[model samples]
Target chain A: MNGPYVAVIGAGQATAEQERVAERVGELLAEAGAVLVSGGRGGVMLASCRGAHRRGGLTLGLLPGPDRAEGNPFLTVTVPTGMGELRNGLVARTADGVIAVGGGWGTLSEIGFAMRLGRPLIAVGSWTVEGPAREPSYPTADTAEAAVSWVLRQLG
Target chain B: MNGPYVAVIGAGQATAEQERVAERVGELLAEAGAVLVSGGRGGVMLASCRGAHRRGGLTLGLLPGPDRAEGNPFLTVTVPTGMGELRNGLVARTADGVIAVGGGWGTLSEIGFAMRLGRPLIAVGSWTVEGPAREPSYPTADTAEAAVSWVLRQLG
Candidate 1:
């Protein structure tokens, strides 16, 4: 399947659990030739960036404010959207699929955006999204391998 | 100062370093009686939430998609903007000053949006916006207290 950019929406600061998950997910995305897109900050986004960078993947950070320099160091390209949390939907739509790790309202919003845009979405521990039909959202393994496997199936 | 509701923008997954900063910032915001606005996810925003929540201050989350259920538990009010990342600027603009913590492109975009709107901005923890301003960009601080202090001065 053609590579797709997947947006991972979550907190800027990551817990140890999140770091483990991000590392695994990063490897999966890199191997599958998918780009990881995030808010370009710390927390889950940065953990994911570190994972992706280690795996030789391309990581894009969609910064909300105006400065490109504020992005996480791992980000290969930083898009200073000059937007705010409102742009969260754009970040979700830009991706073919979405992976939401443990997050708060921002991650929740991105998941909602993914559903609104009809993008395939996968949730790891503590993050979930549903379709209009009231179908329960699919829950994936916390590890990167399981998450990527599910994403590949959706793409297929 | 009018007790401005400053938007703290960043990713959800914060690192250890970020958590320490977040804790400090939370205390400062609480003491300053400033309302914290964010994407309403985790990370720096949540840390702000924890700080503000303790003092019973206001916390607003402008989510990306439609479901308020996806918002952070700490969010006292959740606005479903449904605009995605494109609305990032709107979030930044809703506040009088913007406080960015360890961020990425999304945070960068928030900074950019703040700059474009000519609003005062504060950066903490190496946010790229801290660099010497080519124009009338605001100042930067190593910690959240200093950033909030700087923002209050700007608002004044």
Candidate 2:
């Protein structure tokens, strides 16, 4: 059977804390035998892919630009969409569940799409968006372990 | 030379005012010899496509789902991406300029992508996002004519 596809959404420019969290999240997802998906650029995407790659896990990168070479070296597969920021939607859609690390506008867009598509979502030190009634849409975790565990549980 | 591609973005469920604005935007874009692009479903998308179609303008629908039949019949060409909300990125990328009539989370996502990609963008009765310094990234217009004029001017 195919492994669960879990996307880790974040910004290309991430803080040290976010990068550390993203890497740990990737390693955990890899150990759990889930395929990791990401934007395939730098920062959080690179960190996650590196962790997964070191663990010998399959990693997919949906790159925004036209050059596959631009993807993080750790990606097992790379798809360069040449669609620019639009590829954020693909990164969100191709996953069974989503874990967002520290992010920005792009990550926020992915979060919006993920919520709209009803994908199981978890956030860690990420942007918190409210519904029309001002209720938090998804749960936020404090650690990569919690984020991975929560997202996988939701997938199951 | 090919005509300019202008995307009109908004929610599938729109208010009457938004629909009116979107349709007028479509008419103006078509009259200006521009190609109209959208998510190609209902609400604002259908309204814009309907206006453009009535004006004999070429309308392109980047559908989120797999079925072209789901697209508004006003489209001259329909590309069913089967990418779900990810097609929103394509809608933003394919346009030379973007005009958001009225929106929600989805539109917010598109606005994020458009700004991230540095696409000429405008809003009309739509979401207003603030940047790091609380500055609006794009211009907002009070009417369809003003929005179209501002966006086309930006393109030039």
Best candidate per DockQ, number? 2
- Report the C-alpha lDDT of model 1 over A1-156, residue by residue, as the tens digit: 358888877667567887678767877887788989888888888888888898889999999889988898899989998766656757777888888777655565566457546778777774432221234454656566777888878877
Native contacts recovered by candidate 1, as a share? 0.08
Tens digit of per-residue lDDT, candidate 1, span B1-156: 367777877667777777667656766776787777788777777777877787777788888777888777878889987766655656777888887777644565566556656678776653432111123444667877688788877877
**Alpha-carbon deviation at B69 in model 1, angstroms:** 31
Per residue, candidate 2 scores C-alpha lDDT tens digits across B81-125 of 997787787888788899988787787778777776778998887
- Per-candidate chain B TM: 0.88, 0.96
- Candidate 1: misplaced stretches above 4 Å? A128-135, B1-156
Each candidate's fnat, listed in order, reads 0.08, 0.34
Candidate 2 lDDT, tens digit per residue, A1-156? 287999999888888898999999999999999999999999999999998988889999999889989998999999998977777888777999999887777887897788777889988887654332232467989999999999999888
Per-candidate local distance difference test: 0.72, 0.85
* Cα lDDT, model 1, residue A37: 86
Worst 10 residues of 2 chain B by lDDT: B128-137
Deviating ranges (above 4 Å) for candidate 2: A1-3, A53-57, A64-69, A76-87, A127-136, B1-3, B53-57, B65-69, B77-85, B128-136
